[model samples]
Target: MSDDRFEVVIVGAGPAGAAAALALAREGVEVLVLERGDFPGAKNLFGGILYTSVVNELIPEFWENAPIERHIVNRRWLTLDEDTQIGLDLKSAKFDVPPFNNTFTALRSKWDRWFAEQAEEAGAMVICETNVEELIVEGGTVKGVRTGRDDGDVEADVVILAEGANAMLAERAGFRPQMGPRNRVNAVKEVIALPPEIIEDRFHLEGRQGMALEYFGGAVKGTVGSGFIYTNHDSLSVGVGCLIEEYLRLNMAPYDMLDEFKAHPMIAPLLRGGETVEYATKMIPEDSYDSLSDLYEDGLLLIGDCAGLVNPSIHHEGTNLAMASGVAAAEAVLSARKSNDFSKARLAEYRERLEDSWVMKDLKRYRDTVHFLLENREMVNEYPDLAIRLIRRYFTLDDTPKDDVIKELWKTIRSEVNFLKAARQMWRARKTML
Candidate 1:
């Protein structure tokens, strides 16, 4: 075995690790990325949507060369109440043109491997099938990592921990918190294959154009969770997720929740002929500013999910944050290398870079969002039901008088969440919404 040491060691070859590796390697620095999966994205899943602007900033006009499935021309946010759905849909023809504005949905199984290859091409040595077990520290500073692979103690000037939700290695170095039930969401997503034409027609998309729909309310049964459907080339990515703590309290099994979500009349008709292709469940980190541990400790910095960079309410909005954090980490590493200061104080600049980006600003904005949902679960579950019942009544076209319908609306609202609780919830939601 050869004694090969890199300037930086990154664990987990996901979007964050790959982005950091590509950025650093392009600067002519030795970067090593280690992954436990046989290949990148092998164990990853999401209702995967990749916003191209971020990717283009890392690799210009990346869509032209990237293995993307389709352009997203339509997006819908659906708030559901059993069989009823109220949604906001957005579509633009310009979104399909050069340098697409919105993102496209893709299967991570294919996209992640290709993304990692870009880092490899840029000269970052990515080693997959290697499990990083612990961080190597010396004189109160991280120096490298110890992997589970035989004869796998690799040394580096700095180690960036990008290992997803199980950010144990980073926590060992005191870079993050111990995983708490409320701070994470257990998500299960499945890919269901429909014919390409059917998908296009169902989602109302043009040639290779796709749509994304986010579900609320009944999906997670009032928890601060969601169900989603995103269009791929010939398939629909569908799933539901909720806080692990809430699931425990509600005694909700994820699969049971998924079953209820898919059976909704609105979703069922759309996925009529599709066949389930893949089944996967993983924990998603929901905490942000409060969840972030020591991002920079001595000669190491943590990026991506390891830094607890996810916004819970939005549903797996971590990839963009991860890439941004990785970019910041890479820039900081390059600066430290040039100045020859691998000290903890020198690497703290990475924190400033993150604070200036949306990664930190947005997280700070929703810092109290998770607990808000925990406190007021009825807004998501019961309110939607009340709203739907009112809509159904207003549009029933019965023999009842028109004025009576208006009176019914008030009666239903009072019956279902009660005015006082609704007012308190509206106030709480508004606090962190803006």
Candidate 2:
């Protein structure tokens, strides 16, 4: 290969790009990965959970050597009101063992760089701080990419677009349509430093075990979003995110929501006395599978957020899907290489691989969830408060008879909500989300 050419070029060095580079490089494919950040993960942010099943496939027993902070053995889901919360917490000792249930908490800034290094060590040429200006397209075929550097036009047999949610290059190249606000989520996060002992005590964790907590309803001021807090070794990743369209429609700011989340009565005590060590913001693609953009074209494939691979359901999965898409992209490229074919038909294998994997299956399963929640805002906005009120009333030590309390609760429910409509909504929720 020449200095200005490679067999495959990947834009963005996040999990997807790095995974693809590593896989292709391991197979002796000449892959080049370009990253716009000062280094990989410098500009990436997530809720702190790294689902490592895909990583384990790439590097068996990755948790043994990766810069993993903690293995999550406890998961909690909470519904919040102004000053009250109802929660369900699940803990499993099995998750604390070897595979750790494939869930771990990691700081992206540290993890991304480490992952890219693995790709580099495997023979992929990773160039950081080099922004891909655009794709070099000729006769509707992607030839390579043009970067911001001198002699920037580097040619490649195929180009993989893993450029995060913004997908500027993909948009510019018309590989996908410009994503609207409703199809995206804006999030802000803070890494709050605390004593390790305090973290363990407060979260009921032992050793390197961690807990992941997700909040809905008042968490984002009843917006179509959620808040998350993940326990790290000596810090907490706290953040809130909602639909970009919700942010605009409600005239709200992500930072303000994050502040509110941190200040919530139930949330504040956990983060008390902690110092903020890092703050970052990110955009996530929440597009439904039915609305997903074209995955492949001649000489090109889009993976990760750029391809809208996010599963925006209760699962809250993104990184794992991104890495899986990366591996699939690499497989497709390798297949095409065997025939020296870089046409759209040859690259269709990328989509087929993803369709055959859990990545696409989960996305398809919850394709209607985001839209359903958006349309039925009452499920998130009103139901949590109502449930909390009823539960609080039930647990209150009042002089009234228990039967009277149950009757009163039923009366309140009848007065406040239409039973038929509520039942219908619940059925729809089950169909859309379950």
Candidate 3:
């Protein structure tokens, strides 16, 4: 074999690539990982929730040594109007225990670099600051990858692409179609720094326990998106994201939307005196299960965001699914190596494994959610405002009698809502969202 050749060459060192490398290295496979960033996670961004069930399967009790910010004990779902907020709040002592409901918050820059180090410790060679330009194809099969550096062609029996949402390499290689604006979401986040005590007091957290709050409706100015605030140890990860198509329709910028979200009367008090420590923006692949790209080709596989593995439902799960796909890819590669066949047929096992796991099942179940929400813009734009007004009227002290108050509320509902249309929308939500 040439000096640059390996048993497997994996691109990008995010959760998916790192998990693949770790699993392969543990089995004594000669694997090389190429990372474009100065290090893994340097350019990665997410909404700050890390569902750790997949991580536990990869490295048992990972939170003990991982760079985790906090274990979430409180989860709140809020809907906002211009001046009012109302929703459900659930806080449980059950989530404060070990395993912590498999939920935690982490900064990707710290988490990704640390995860790649685990692969390195397991004997995988991870090279950073090297950009993979394209796949080296021969006779209709992938042979390796061509990097930007001189003599940068690296050979492998098989290659895995964990490149993120932009997926230039996947597009160039004809592995997938170009993602449309409807299939993409542009997210912006800022890590706001504050004293640990202040953070705990503000968010009602104790010790390493944390809170995750999700905002909808007027949070994004009634756009088809959501806002989030996750409590880290001494910082808050505050962000908002929406469909790129919505941004174009509204003729608005993401940063400007973020500023408006921060200035909201209901949102400002929580972040009254914080310093911005880090800000980032990235595009997330939100393709539905029906539109997901093909997972494998001749001697090649795609995982993570490159495969459009994000579950864009209310759960907002991506990292866990990405890591799960990585492990499946590694298992498929190991099985293929035993037979010394790295053909497209052999890599079919990767897709089969994903289909058998929760990764694909959850995605398939929520296949219609994004489209359903998009079609019913009133769900975000009008419903929340209507709900808040009704709740506020119910709570306000007035001179009207109880019977009169009930009559007034019914009148308002009748005037503002079409009962038949609402019933149909609610029934559709039961199938698509619930």
Output the worst ten-in-a-row residue range by lDDT, candidate 2.
1-10
Query: Weakest 10 consecutive residues, lDDT, candidate 3?
Result: 1-10
Give the TM-scores of the predictions, in the order they appear: 0.96, 0.98, 0.98
Candidate 3: tens digits of C-alpha lDDT, residues 1-434: 23589999999999999999999999999999999999998888899999999899889999999999999999999999888999999999999998999999999999999999999999999999999999999998999999988889999999999998888888888898779889899999999998989989988888999999999999998877899999998899999999999899999999999999999999899997999999999898888899876789999999999989999888999999999999999999999999999999999999999999999999998888889888998888888889989988988898988888888899999999999999999999888877
lDDT winner, 1 or 3: 3
How many clashing residue pairs appear in each of the predictions shown?
A: 0, 0, 0
> Per-candidate RMSD vs. true structure?
1.6, 1.2, 1.2
Better of 1 and 2 by TM-score: 2
Give the clash total for candidate 3.
0
- Any idea how many clashes model 2 has? 0
TM-score of 2: 0.98
Which lDDT tens digits does candidate 1 get at residues 65-175?
Answer: 777888878888778776677767889888888777748788887888899999999999988889988888888988788888777888999999889888888767666
Cα miss at 210, model 1 (Å)?
A: 0.6
Off by over 4 Å in 2: 1-3
Q: Give the worst 10-residue stretch by lDDT in candidate 1.
A: 311-320
